[model samples]
Target: MVEGKGEAYLLIDVGHVLTHAAYIARVEGTARLAAVAEVTTTTAAEGGLLDGVRRATANLELLVGRQILDRAGEVRQPRDGDGHGVDGVVVTASLAPLLRVALVGLTCDFSLASAVRAATLPYVSLERTVSLEGPGDAWDAEDLEALVQEPPEVLVIVGGADGGPVAPIREMGETLSTAYSLLAASQRPAVVFAGNERACRPLEATFAGVVEVSAVANVRPSPEKENLGGLQGELAHLFYKRLGRSEGLRQLGTWAGSALRHDLDALARTLRFVACRHGLARGVLGVDAGGNGCRVLWVRPRGPALNWAAPFGLGSGLGALRQRRDPTAVVRWMCHPISWAEAWDRLSNIEVRPGGVPETEEDWDLQQAALREALGATWQGAVRAWAGYAEGQAVGEADMIVARGTSFTHARTPGQAALMLLDALQPTGLVRLALDWANLLPGLSGLAERDAQAAVQVYDNDALLELGTLVAPRGVLRPGSRALRVRLTVAGEERAELDVPAGSIRRLPLGVNERGRLELYPARGLDVGLGRRGRGGVVEVRGGALGIIIDARGRPLGLPKDEEARRAALEAWQREIEQA
Candidate 1:
């Protein structure tokens, strides 16, 4: 695809918990992934971040049974006759520090809300959200000192719709200029103006030489629409520019031929590419959880959208985990009752050893509980982002769901991963569940833009493991009520008829790579993405290690208030899937 023969491409993905290197070679003019290796990512190592990269690369070389780097410690390009080198290298990272951002806008409810949404991407963190409507003292010496003391890397100024609120916009601009003047030149933050258009020139003049300034179209152009594309793009560019200043990242970028990209962007690109390629108009949903953060990407027919939350995971984010709303939220997912203190203590260990894996049944239960809570929070954040951008736009419309992270990838079985997602997201429709367990999507992300066909072929063929197709209908019913009737045909085998009861989870065996035809009929008042209750439809689905899971757990999936009852329900669900 890159106009070469026997070309070898190396892809490296750096994350807070792990660094992975994958070697892909164009063998006989066909690109194929050769080997993959991973190493713990420790920033304190002598070589800093590059330490893990080098280790992972070395391990990958061992797997490929060749030398990819020279003695001088550089990736050797142009493979020799014996296949000792790669043609090019690309790097992607999720381990970059969050860009601290100060958002200045007209009001907290309107423009500020939009600014918050723009600033909450995986790589950008909102340090301050300042409203221009407040008193003049809001920008006083004390306030300015607080902002300038430890300057944020970027300042995002967004206010009223185009052709609206000129004076407020000017005042905010003047305030920003004053704040910019207080910061040391070396520490001054870049400023982005996405406010009223008429005020751009004056604002540009006000801070022209004092600080770096870029102006884009108003985020709220006319009250009816918000144009965040230009601002989002600018923010991404600035984030990368700041990230490149790091010592290790700079060197990695150089070796990558400036092909370094953000992990969230890569995830978004991969999902969008897959959905569009497959013509899946209902869109695809992807969620990635890691030691430092969590990311959710939704790809629709129009394009890809994202939501990010940081310091809120099962591992190194324990500090932020303490700030969550309720401690008991996760307990309901566990099979046995555990005190909040005990649960917190178990999770605290993950902060110390982010890559630790469960070895015992108790450990597994605790780990799954934490994962369930983290995913629920991540989903809620994504929903909020969608609400901020467009009313009534929810993630439920997604017909396919893909997940990544240690919890999903390292689960004992595909059924474990599927149940975790089902319990956390609780969608009321038929959906396909898959896991990026192989960590191939990030590599594909780097390759998609270069050799799209190769990247896609690899993704569909190897990247994802189809967990199973899930059918979850909405609406609650009596415990003994018949929720659905399913007729399934798989692998030349046909199931006469199966009835799934309300508040239960049922699994049917279907081998991997097997095709299946399903006819689903929901009882009265139940709906599985169909128009109404008593509706039915026939769909084609592919099988995986775990077959089709029919969950009549009801929408907003309920849990018994009685602790034992809740534990029993959870145990039953886990048993139902795990037995498969």
Candidate 2:
């Protein structure tokens, strides 16, 4: 407690594998991150989530030399006479199990597909989807029974564009009401109506006493407009309510005085703020991969689009990588050959002990390859969702890509981190890379609501670790052809020029705090974000520990077909970045 100018914040994020806490103290009218600590998340422990929170806070207390909790193990609020306590506590968690969901819609391509996109959000898993076309549509009684047996936490009903046909939606509502009447009061899942506005009131009436009914704005308002934020916000609210019922959350909520914030949403909003602050036109892309899932949030001027894949992450969700992508995708990135059996064994070990880290050199290689595959799957899913929801619009190129989670934050070096991002996301054009090393994005987000200037101060001064800027062309040149010829002039420093060959990545030494002027000349048939082949442009570039990296690897990043040749190529690229 710093006596009133601003408030101190103790932000805690309860993840599946780890419970992380950050302490941000306002000093001289600016928010400064004091310390960060993490411990194993113990959701099943007898003490509940409070136990983990207390442990993490205690660790922070040791680092900051201040007491955050009282003798009875309660968060000390206010000054506490000696000014040893914090002003307020902010909490966010991603430890809750995903809700089982049943999707019901009139059309598979429109309403149902949009519902599928909504279900992809964090904390909800699509358990089943039933499409009811019209009055003539036949639904199997046994299938309905099976769905009821599974007992979805929520049933989403969506269909019929605005001012579109009404009779079919009415029929579908009646059918759903009949199905709801068959289940006992305790077994019925909550119903969320996000279809035609006209049908919303009637649908709520249809299920009024039978079950809980929540009517939100239609997910797909028409063929061209998609209003998902209203529905997504509602779902997030409901999820927070359910999460509050947990023993761990119940205790924390009582102490924090506010409901726990959704970690992914908090991070997304923070990234949006950062991008807007910098006046970035291309917007920001964020990837948070952890034991439970990978959450991708892309925010542009148009709006923010999010996709949460519950089963595609580096830890417990690794199995989804194999399911959603080619089984050999991880192996393809590896220089040394690893048989499927060997890969599976390594993956199985990771799945069982998700918090484990790589020890040996072989282990590190396997982890990096596996992480790349997970990130790729996540990026592809997000892009597909953006295309569908944004009216055939695509994420052209992100101005900033922020990589979060343990895999990226704990990498051995900035070089390794840059290479992993390049290999996984394969971003085109010129882009800036940063990592959430302290896991402070959530904390900054929480603070933004209370003190925006403080939030931005901490972010720009203490939070994001700039991993340098990358310039990668979209098109490919002939093998060994000049992909990009560039002249880099560091501000108040010397200037240098280099010709980078196709299918290679080169790094120029530019330390952090130095800005450079770059004149880019791509070869014929190549595009470096700007249109037209061989077109040149001048742009300002920022520096990080790894400096400026130029990746000429063909879009889609080609690899040698022969085993030995592929190994040699992978080794050569690794040396250029990781071993340099």
Candidate 3:
């Protein structure tokens, strides 16, 4: 794609449930998608992770008419003169086990919060958090015993300002040393010190022969400032180190060279890249509702990206979701009638068969309902950490909302997928909706490490499947009252004029890639992102599979508490979009 390089490139993603491969080639200075294939993950097979990759590549070879895999069943590094193989390979994976970590800090509100944020990757699980904010400086006997009994893969110690007192930090290190002494050398956790600069050397010396030690910049350099970049980077490095322990991953990494990346890391990087590339003032929000976990990322132009991941998803993570929320919480989003016991049984079946598909309409509804709640919970966590919103508020506005994972990609219809996101996120103002249908984001991000221009070209041209624009006004009015009025013009001709009522959603037809001009007049109390209530103006809009969606159901979308009424309302809304 760049000047004198080869044309064909291969990208692979090994997820918990599936393995995906995409073939893209540079053509006339533009990256174009040639083919895509997916197969069930083979990490547990005899061949391990490489089996899944080879099978996916074998499928790609059939579609592209090339010999991507040689006689030995390994990926061909460089393309032959006749273009029988690929020029480059990039791999991103989420099939590895979650990295277990323990956090030790001086206080709950400051150092502990920073450590939690730094370890919020989807592949990371916090096994324990010890907050030493009480009167006594000595470590509790129970805490030390717990560490020895269940040693984490990594131990993160964070506290103190740059020039603050080091006595508490040194005491913390002494307690850790006592705990590490009980475990064998192989069982001792790696230590990462991200606290006072003065304590770094002492902590390293304390854990010298006990475990691996790494020191990074202070997470809270001062009471007024929090610098998380250094800590987050160090955690990522540790994650790679842990992942590299797998022989399958080791072999795959060798093939990928420097282009290998963790799935969530790649997703976050791509989200930031998209925000900066388009100069989006409101930024971009990405929700990945995968099988193993759910991730929510909000990337703005200037500030640090806010990320939240929970081990609650549609498949293997369903048990965690059940434990976290009341079972009725999921049932509340379903339009169809089903008993709580029956719903629970079906969910249990999904847990047993993580890769199984819903065969009945009720089963499908249950899965979607759970997906909404999982996404909502993950989003709430991110919002609480973002510092931008007050309590009980919808997600802030964004220029674009990108949806990933099978929950969205495999929806029965585009409208169904759009509704799921709209209900969960409840985004306000103007925003473009898109779906990562091909699961290409992680691979594209991996490719970016080798050729930035080629990656950007592919992302801009073929990465996301746009799902039209969303115009949601924020306000409360009577259910049947006027919420907003819209006049749509396409190709200099008037197309439609309608009044959208409160507590209702309306979709206007504009076709894919069609441009339209909208003249909007919000109600006296409603604001459609035009600065004030009742303010009216004209703005350009684009269309996609679902056309233009006008949601006037208020900012914090409310559904009737009465089960019958809720079902009726949900059914009506679904019919509206399907008919459109």
Q: Judging by lDDT against the true structure, name the best candidate.
A: 3
Candidate 3 lDDT score relative to the true structure = 0.82
- At residue 104, candidate 2 shows an lDDT of 83
**True-structure RMSD, every candidate:** 3.8, 3.7, 3.5
- Relative to the true structure, how large is the alpha-carbon lDDT of every model? 0.77, 0.79, 0.82
Candidate 1 stretches with Cα past 4 Å from truth are 1-6, 27-29, 100-152, 158-168, 179-188, 195-198, 208-210, 217-230, 256-258, 323-329, 390-392, 490-493
Preferred candidate (lDDT higher): 2 or 3: 3
TM-score of 1: 0.87
lDDT of 1 at 21: 84
Give the alpha carbon lDDT tens digit for every residue of 45-154 in model 2.
44677788889999999998889888988877764556588877778777767677888888788878877776656456667888866466767677677666676888
The TM-score values for the models, in the order shown, are 0.87, 0.87, 0.88
Cα lDDT tens digits for candidate 1, 1-580: 2333336778888888888888887666667777878788868655687778888888988899889888876787767789898766768888777678888777777777776766656567667766756675255466566677867888888887877757767666776777678767878888899877887877787786788679987877766777777788889988888777887778777864646777777777777777887677777888887877666777765633555554677777765766775867667788967888887777778778888878888889988887888778878776765654543555435878999988888888887888889887887687878998768786787776666666766776678888888888989988769999998886567854689999988877776787788889899879987777778998887777778888898988889889899898888888888764
Report the Cα lDDT for residue 532, model 1.
77
Worst 10 residues of 2 by lDDT: 388-397
In candidate 3, what are the lDDT values of residues 1-580, reduced to their tens digit? 2223557889998888778999988778677888999887875555788888888999999998888888988777677888787778888887666678999999888877777777766557777988887877557778878887999988999998888887788777887887788778888888889898988887777776677678999988888888888888887888888778877787877764434678777887888888888787777888889787788777667555556677888888888888875857788899988887787788888876776778989888999998998888877777765554322324445799999988898899998999999999988888899999999987888777777777888887788888899999977888989999999999999998999999888988888779999999999998898888889899999898888999888977898989899999989888877655
Q: Between 1 and 2, whose lDDT is larger?
A: 2
Total backbone collisions for each predicted model: 0, 0, 0
What is the lDDT ranking, best to worst? 3, 2, 1
